[model samples]
Target: MRRPLLSEALLDTIRSRAGGYDASNTFPHEDLADLTAAGYLRAFVPVERGGAGLTLREVAREQMRLAAAAPATALAVNMHLVVTGLAAIQADRGETALDFVLDDAARGEVYAFGNSEAGNDLVMFDSRTRAEPQADGSYRYTGTKIFTSLSPVWTRLATFGRDDTDPDAPLLVHAVVARDAEGIEVLDDWDVLGMRATQSCTTVLTGVRAPADRVHRRLPAGPSGDLFMFSLFAAFEILLAAVYTGIGRRAVELGVAASHRRTSMKNGGRTYAQDPDIRWKVAEAAIVQDGVEIQVESLARDVDELVDHGPLWFPKLVGIKVRAVEGARYVVDQALRVSGGASYGSSGELGRLYRDVLAGIFHPSDEESAHATVANAYLGPLER
Candidate 1:
């Protein structure tokens, strides 16, 4: 299939100042502006709501290309898209959120998802982040969530937590909190190894009142109420795959360009690419990326099919996500290895690729619950 133009454009921008960006640890604001102008936000948002309304499969493909160009930016943007998809799914809340997102895009308002909590028992969903119901059905949210990406620039946040009462609610509500809410603070505490531009700072919630409409499903809002956990969770896999693919491609491309200039060990004058061993290594990187693309494509298709069928095929999505993340790591590692010491050099492109790929392992996207879903799908049917 032909590559998308968005990927090429973003890559061009990234390449222009990649070394400087990484060295300075700066967000690709220009690239983000371009992406926004290019209607990338609408790429995953619903078409009915002024977005491109691309299918699940198409969304994956598009995001893969975008991520390959700038993984950190792509990933940070995925946070918004995930929440947008969640907003798209809720009939009552979905339309309203989409309208606001469209306005934000029109007004150039950036957003990010803030879901993880600090010191609140994430396991039990104890979510110390409490939201007390107030008069007129509004809620006053209080708690601190760390690792909130793209703040200051982010005008909005999509957060998840249990209600003041009824932890066993039929659904888990995802609320949208404005940045200027009465008692919220955006803390700068992100010290990540890679994808540094993500700006994953901490966002504190203290006595911030969110109206009922802005509050998606209230506490006791069961887990199954939001398919976004499954949808964008699946889409994030595509993003992960794309990030490594881009890194691998850049590494191989740079390696090929540099290898020809290097003297070969086998012969006094032969260059690295001229030697069989180095040529094989470079070729292997290409082969690995090709394989990963196929896997990502298959997963996207499975997800799209599930969207049409509904519920029964969720297991396949989870499995594909696990495999995609694994594929991304493997692909990038091979590319880095083939590129050799140049990849590790402070000035080289490969060094950045190494850091970006490492971020995948630490991302909360690869949680144990998702892994268990894959296991359950494969093993749960055995007793039957």
Candidate 2:
């Protein structure tokens, strides 16, 4: 009897506006406003802090529902959720280091993940950006981050850079930089093939100063078993999987509806739902979508319940992300196939879904890296 996170009317409004936003290649400012008014931005902040206090699992389910309505909006919001969710998770476990993040979110500040670099394959483990220590304890970062979602309106950007000041003890400095801080430039160069509403523009940082207090962690250049790292991976991977799973679910629904609406010429104008081949395609897509949904929900639940997977945590996280993304891609492709030639049109919902789902592969834990992580976890490192 619990109420839905996104009401049907709000979802319908968001869905109706999606095509216009995607077609115009503009950020969904209206969608953001609507979501913000619904308190979606602070879903993870503790209720005592004037927020929803939703668990990660609840938020993940909400994200799936949002993505089904407007994927770009959902994906962009996912970045903010990742930051806030990380802080909430850490705080829930008695770590107060990131309590400021939750506080800021509760106070109406928006955050974005500005950690992605153009050529850095190591992801959170390493950074191509340079972090120089200042006379005080603060650090100045200089580098460019690509695919920075919520670029247009994010107030704080969570990013990291490498500090080689001490070559023998190099560190990856993680910090949250205020968007209006001096020496930070957000470029309007987000033109892309998909996820147009994300406005994930390129961010150029030239000595952007992060006050010492805002600088969170300084871990070694490579992977480390830090709580912050675990929180980040858990929130990011699970929520990201949720978004793609939602996309696959929507695609399956679209395919089924299309089958019922389209008539087959060869069978006396009978609906495609009567065509065995179309039905089979719909069934196949539904099966894959079902598995992806289950995997995402299960992983989110485990994280919420604090299930001890130990070393397998990373493998499980990356595995679900890869599976959900790939499965979504397949489901969208199948949906496009069964929807007939009209779906090939640029304005068609399936066409947009097809484009948006492609952005999944480009997210962190790419297929190559996910495989390598799993391989190392199972077979051990390759002879050092």
Candidate 3:
């Protein structure tokens, strides 16, 4: 957290390049280049591996700070860290490979996702693609993944699929695949209103083979006794909320700067900022943003404290995730209203934030499953 030092200079870089990135609908390659070179992406790897080894709170803070600058790059980097960290843990890839990832992190290598199938919402694990085993322990993977964030730019990817050998296995198989492989096709198909700079596209895999060791198994439950099994979902929710909050904060910051520089049309007010109505709107926006931030941060803080000292409570974490999503929706609505037409324009990061903020309600981590989880915990056994 202290290490990144996200200064005004860093923010200015993001602001300076944001327009160009949004205009091209291209990846925030320049920003990510800075993040990687600065080792921002590797800050969470264990300290034993020479990482900054920040806590969940620290991760959340840095994610928001960077996301405040450019949501697309922040989301891309966050996706990479989540994927690589999951793969790195449990020494899944014979320890040596995971070690290599840590080393790569130390050296500034970033990652991405290649798991969303066309017509398949990433939230459902049952939406598995094909992976057939070969004579070797390895398997040949053939499938097409859509909307893969950071795919074209990142060297590594975490892809989900089903094993042909275990057709009925109640598990989702996640494989760590490289960006460059024979028969792997990257499509230039991502053009959206939000998170446009992520360079998300369709990636087609045609009989690509990777060692079975490269594949990792992700079970339905978190490791037993690990409150984080449920708590991290809360953390993810809070972070998304934080992302929205940061966007709101940036909208205010940009709006304030513009108001001082641009005069109001009504009554020839000295500046848009001086009108009583404009002043009231900005005040209202700040209050709403601050309230949402406090609530989300409190939820995250409570979840962390519970994980460390409170009783093992699953429902609480689920509730936090649900509420965090709610806060995001409210804060984003306020941001758009406060920023006005300027935000909707493609020239600023506010519109990009608008696009990514809506995802808070639908991202696999925050929406539908959470409602069921919380309901099951509080409502008791179901009737047929």
Best by lDDT: 2
- Which pairs clash inside model 1? 47-53, 169-220, 170-220, 170-222, 171-220, 171-221, 171-222, 172-221, 172-222
lDDT of 3 by residue, 261-346 (tens): 66766757588678677677667766766776676666655543434433325455445545545654555555566556777775
Candidate 2 ranges beyond 4 A from true positions? none
Write the number of the candidate with greater TM-score, choosing between 2 and 3. 2
Q: Where is the poorest 10-residue window by lDDT in model 2?
A: 1-10
Per-residue CA lDDT of model 1 for 66-182, tens digit only, reads 665666776777777666544443323333534555455444556687767755433223466776777887777777877676764788777765564553453345567777788
RMSD of 3: 4.2
If ranked by lDDT, best first, what sequence of candidates would result? 2, 1, 3
* Superposed Cα deviation of residue 174, candidate 2 (Å): 0.6
Model 1 residue 337 CA deviation in Å: 2.1
* Cα lDDT, model 3, residue 213: 73
Instruction: List the candidate 3 regions with Cα displacement exceeding 4 Å.
Output: 1-5, 85-100, 121-124, 164-170, 218-239, 255-280, 295-329, 339-344
Worst 10 residues of 1 by lDDT: 86-95
For residue 320, what is the lDDT in candidate 2?
A: 94
Candidate 2 local lDDT, 216-274, one digit each (tens): 99999998889999999999999999999889989999999999999988999999999
TM for every model, in the order presented, reads 0.83, 0.98, 0.80
> How does residue 41 of candidate 3 score in lDDT?
79
Q: How many residue pairs collide in each prediction?
A: 9, 0, 0
Top-down TM-score ranking: 2, 1, 3
